[model samples]
Target: MPYATAPDTTRIAYQVRGQGTPLVLLSGQANDHHWWDTVRDDFHPARRTVTLDYRGTGMSDKPDRPYSTEGFAEDVIAVLDDLGIGRADVYGTSMGGRVAQWVAVRHPHRVRRLVLGCTSPGGPHGVERDPAVSTALSDADPAAARRTLLDLMYTPAWQARQPGLLGRSTVLGDPAMPAHARRRHRLASARHDAWEALGHVTAPTLVLHGTDDRFNPTANAPLLAGRIPGARLHLIPDARHAYFEEFRTVASPLVLDFLGAP
Candidate 1:
């Protein structure tokens, strides 16, 4: 329940766990730290994991104002500064990944390593998600939105095994989140364009995605990997948007190796 004050004077809530080299985990779209609930344990004990709710989500202040990936990145840096953490490994997924790009580019000295998952560089050069997917995800009906979000995230087999995943998956346009905040999150994410600034990232980077991902096209992985100097790309075959959670058995070990897990 600890909090940090963003430059805008907005209060950002964050949580810290374990005790080792800091690892910052960023959430996607309109979601909060709960987005990492499933994969967090994979890095526990070996790293001091940090998770936060963006200014518009979770336990943070929800302001009726403009938001951008750079702004979100600043919020993250503010949290780190509050914690007295000078630098740390960063892992961001979906919109969070886009925010991480800005963090690495604008604040190079503060990132030890970077992991971008199921995300895009944005603008014209990036491969965008299908408009239908967006339409379905942003459906006015909460139940329909949840169904679409779950479908886009996990495969049928995976969904079948996890009986109530649809109920639990409430990141994007869930009714629990304020409508204004969700719009802000979507707008902030849509405006993210990091392709031009990616070259400045000096941290060892990993760009990963699920091959079958439709939410954030898998094609963006190679584009990101190629743009960033020395960045590596990994695609989980047959995995969808929730690859990190569905295929953790493979994804976790690979990321752990790259992070030099203790």
Candidate 2:
């Protein structure tokens, strides 16, 4: 229920849990602060985790205008400033990863380390999602949207074996995203081009992806690690776009180690 006021006068809802060095968690496009619930617990014990609703999502103010990664990045800084956190580690997934790039590049002194999961630099060099996957993401029906996304998020075997886990992802079902907001986020994601600016990031970085990511192509992982000096790339086998969720047991430890958690 906590909120931070952005410089533009928009209210951003955020949550702080556990206690340690700040670790901000940024969710993917169209998802709210709740989307990080799947992996939230893993970081909470060893880190003071912060999660927020992007401008057009969750409890945050939903402006009907266009959105940009840079704007999203500012929202993050606003939340951190409100919390009195001068610097923090960041973990960004999918579209959130693009925004994190801006945060590290534009606000270099504010990031201690960075983690980009299932995301890309997002430019001419990035690989686009499959046409079928893109169509599913644009579906209006909430149930249909969940089904399509779950299929792309996890592999067939994993889904079959983890039926209960699927229900966890459906917690935020009512009043699904409107068409306009969805398109705005999509456009914002598409217009992100940080390939040229990535080298400016001085924070130690970790790039993660699943071998079978259906949304952002897996190849984007290497491109990110290669471009950022000293960045390491880790690929999860038999996982998809939601690799962090599907392989949290493995992913969590890797992230904690990178963050120097005990």
Candidate 3:
């Protein structure tokens, strides 16, 4: 477990693997680096991969306050500084994509390339969950929250294939998550609005979304692709929010091609 002390003195845990150009992987809401294991090998064989557990998510120290996107962004910069990495490509999904967007706008020189998956620019057009789902997420029982998340995360087919994965994921999430962290995560998410910042990003960008994504629709792909100069959009059909898991064979190759581009 490699740990870096953030400016706020919070210890962030991360893992580095492979070799070549550094590529940082940021997980989605409530998820850790394990979410990338499904597609890690697909990145260029020569590229180095860095995956970290956000402050409250995995092996990292969870603080009670300052869980804002700005705070998380600072944590990312702290990691780069600690590692002595001048710049690196970034791949972010869902909430992590929002962080990546912030990184590009705030520290443009540090990003070589950017990949946003199953995410949006966060504005009026951004996707929003049903009120019921949202309410369930804030419930006292972590299991209920987990079920609601699972419902929004994957399509019916995925649920059928992996019956107990959601329960297990929820159990793992409950112990690692603190109420304060969850509240902060929600606040950071609700307050996020990146539409105005898109034009500030100069890195080569790629947006990937699934046609059947209920949580964040495929329309978001174009919204993002259109906002970032030279950004390209790829839409996977018959896929849902968890497109990477449901369609890894297709998703991985597309990602590999995009990131491997010269």
Q: What is candidate 2's lDDT per residue for 77-175, written digit by digit as tens? A: 999999999999999998889999999999999999999999999889888888988888669886787788788888788788876755677323214
lDDT of 1 at 89: 96
Error of 2 at 26 (Å): 0.5
Instruction: Output the worst ten-in-a-row residue range by lDDT, candidate 1.
Output: 167-176
Model 1, position 108, has a per-residue lDDT of 96
Report the Cα lDDT for candidate 1: 0.89
- 1-262: candidate 1 lDDT, tens digit per residue: 7999999899999999987889999888988888888889899888899999998888899999998999999999999999999999999988889999999999999999999989999988999888999888779997887788888888999888988776675444334578788898889999888888999999999998999999999989999999999998999999998888889899888887888833
The lDDT per prediction is 0.89, 0.88, 0.80
Tens-digit lDDT track for model 3 on 1-262?
Answer: 8888998899998888888889998777766677777677766566888888888877888888757666777788888887899999998888888889998889999999999999888868576756766687778896786677677777777788887877554222435577787677767866778898899999999898889776766777898999999998899888877777778899878777777789
Which sections of candidate 3 miss by over 4 Å?
Answer: 136-142, 169-174
**Quick one: how many clashes does candidate 3 have?**
0
lDDT of 3: 0.80
lDDT of 2: 0.88
